[model samples]
Target: MEINPAVTFKHDRSIMYAKRPKVLIVGAGLAGLTLGMLLHKADIPFEIYERAQEVKPLGSAMYFNSTTANFFKQCGIYEEFLAIGKYVSSIQVFNEVRGHEFSMDFEGQEAEFGANGYIVARPVMYDLLLRQIPRERIHLGKKVLTMDQGGNGVLLRFSDASEAEGDILVGADGAYSAVRQGLYAKLKKAKRLPSSDDLPLPFSTVCLVGQTRPLTAEEFSDIGLEQCQFRRTIGMEKMYGWATFTTAQNTVAYNVIQFLTDETSKQNDAFRNSEWGPEAAMAMCEQVKDFPIVSGDDKELTLGDLFEWSDKNHISKVMLEEKVFKTWYDCRTVLIGDACHKFSPSGGVGATNAMHDAIVLANRINGLPFHPIAEEIENAFREYKAERVEWVQKAFDSSKAFKTMTGQSFASKATRFVSKHMPAWLFQRIQAQTCANRPQVAFLPLHNDTGRIKPAPQPSLSVRAPVEAETPVAATTATATTTTTEVV
Candidate 1:
């Protein structure tokens, strides 16, 4: 019943693990696949297991920028994207109910800074990544149940009873990662970590996400909705209908409905004791009747409640939790994509951030040893977090600003009279930190290339010598002199 720790490091073939250090990727989604492809290009041996029996092609759009596009190019998967991606020149930011909107032109790649962003379908993107690697290396229907540390390595136990061991274990898995759960249990027991459980969530907010028919070519031309657009239906408060192109087949669409801040409205009653679905969506909508979003004009919006708030402990439930819903992480395990950081799809960055994590980590891992990865891998994670801190904060601040700028409440309407002309410096400062303005950086680890160089030997993440001395030089010195005096 007790599984021992595996301290496996990336290494050369040995008697112990002839096929050791074989990375067992838990999830087969974008992040997992990106990690796999980058490792394969570096000639690192790895295997990815997907819970699903096949590569899933559902889900709607993920906004990808030039950096992500360039990443695809770096991984030798760009042309394929161009083949499937819907390219456009700009994204129109508009009010949902009203026709008023502004457009940001996507300048040329060379003169312009940051990534040329695009909307990607989950399946198309996955299929493209799959093409770059050998099919034999990827396993389907392999569900990872739990894992534990082994001697110099980690053992992965699957539900079907299959197992795998690896030098370094990565939870490239998403936010709700099992690997994250395992690492958190170990780290929390030791208790030198910070409280990540403090992530404040939607104050009595619920999200409704569902797919409807995609846009017709005529609709695209009429709205001038080339890349992406925002439409706000203005009456009193303001709830905008956000629309984006998912796939060319015109089948994938994500319609969102969310409510916030104001909790005492009659609409809250509907969701308070509801089953959490269409009923919830309509109830949330009832509160926003003052500012109605065009449900269906160009096309009808199909909506369904995607996730709900429940406070019950995993299975032991004294009661269903309703405070806020979010997850945290640890050193051995990490939260990637939506699992680590979540956002209000009200302003669609959830999926984009997820893809960005995949690419950022891939760039860092490319051509380098992930095991003895520079302490910067931690920093890369930090930088990734840093990169997101402002971006997400800005997003949150921006979301609040969106409400405040337009005067949501009596207090906001009063505050709205104050600053119509914001300073230019603050705007420039924010623009500077963006991944679009800057390519998110990841570290490249070092390893030997025997076949490519001399026929030396296939290199690996083999464990290195013992931990270098952390003690100060003064402590190690047997004898020391304050001053050099030859006199005696």
Candidate 2:
């Protein structure tokens, strides 16, 4: 089949392609699934392997901020997202005794960013993204045992002894990423891995999260409201805190966090293939079940009520690890999401940053020449890191700041005071920075920016702009497709 020469489309500036490189993505979480969708839109050949036997409602809720809204529009999923999520304008904060401390209002965020942020249950968000990819491309229960890259391509060995080969490997497999472990093992053997990369992901907090079954308006008075009711309470004497967000589904998503001491954090530094199971979730739930919620009603509503209304299987417990690795890629292998930087959930930017990582990495991969050499591949990876590392650090610091604000430490108390009294201009500036890094699929038709503040410059958007050919160009290989949109 020949593609029409007159058909206008974007073209890569790099080497001409005989075929697109095949990508093997480890993990079907937000980052990997997002990259898969972008690659598919770019007509790149790729497959995703998830270690889980099935995708579960593992996380509680995710906040869709301005950074990701436009990409959702580009992917044609913005409407669906809005349908399943509750529009959030502010986060109300409270002290341990339930006294209102202050509110972090995002009142003009929509006007400034051209998109409103939403809070959606994790399962609902996951299902929405999962539907964007072809069923056959996602392989469940296929855990990566080992991985290696050569001058020609990359190879993966699964726990089942099955093998797969691809031109690129992406480690979007979360905090205890096996792909990262394997890649670091190889790098360490060659003495190329940095000393910091050898250390475990230090975590200072543990979190239990879940979404309750849909409740009647009578059950949760806030459920009847059009806007999301997001409330967080910091423990006064206890070293724990809790939050609840009402979703569009009439379900309540909640999280309870246990702030650990330095000694406790060090002692609990360990990795697990299954981050949390039913037993562990249940155990944590029992500990925080008595925690009070700011559910507006005069009748005291505690976490116990939500826990009782939630599905036992849906609850999850996870460690909140904060780190941004210095090394992101080497040879044909690269990392994204928690694999590279694991952020605390305090800022609610973990998932957003993960998807942003997907956007940048996908843009880089789409620009690669077919069967690119190690140097070319490494160059692309370097660009990806350069574009993302600084932003990731910013997000890490932001998350840490928020986490500290809710802590019981003397520093945390000072942070809380400063946060409550923070100037409006400084607050607005920080909010702008949060929305400024919105990145979209560079190989696809770009979404027009509608926000008042121009987004921070995205290098990929300009460098990887799709070009229109004046004449007929050769089609891609059978396995790889080229995505094109007709000009109106």
| Candidate 1: residue 219 Cα off by (Å) | 6.9
Give me the overall lDDT of model 1.
0.45
lDDT of 2 by residue, 243-342 (tens): 9999988899999989988776664454333366678789888888888887767657889999999999989888887889988998889999999999
lDDT of 1 by residue, 262-377 (tens): 55434544444212444444454344334323322454332221111111111110101122113333332345654455454444455555566655444433422234222323
Best by the lDDT measure = 2
lDDT of 2: 0.83
- Compared with the true structure, all predictions reach lDDT values of 0.45, 0.83
Give model 1 RMSD, 1 decimal. 10.9
Runs in model 2 deviating more than 4 A are: 1-17, 262-274, 465-488
TM-score of each: 0.63, 0.91
Clashing pairs in 2: 5-471, 5-472, 9-467, 10-466, 10-467, 11-467
Cα-based lDDT at residue 461, candidate 2:
67
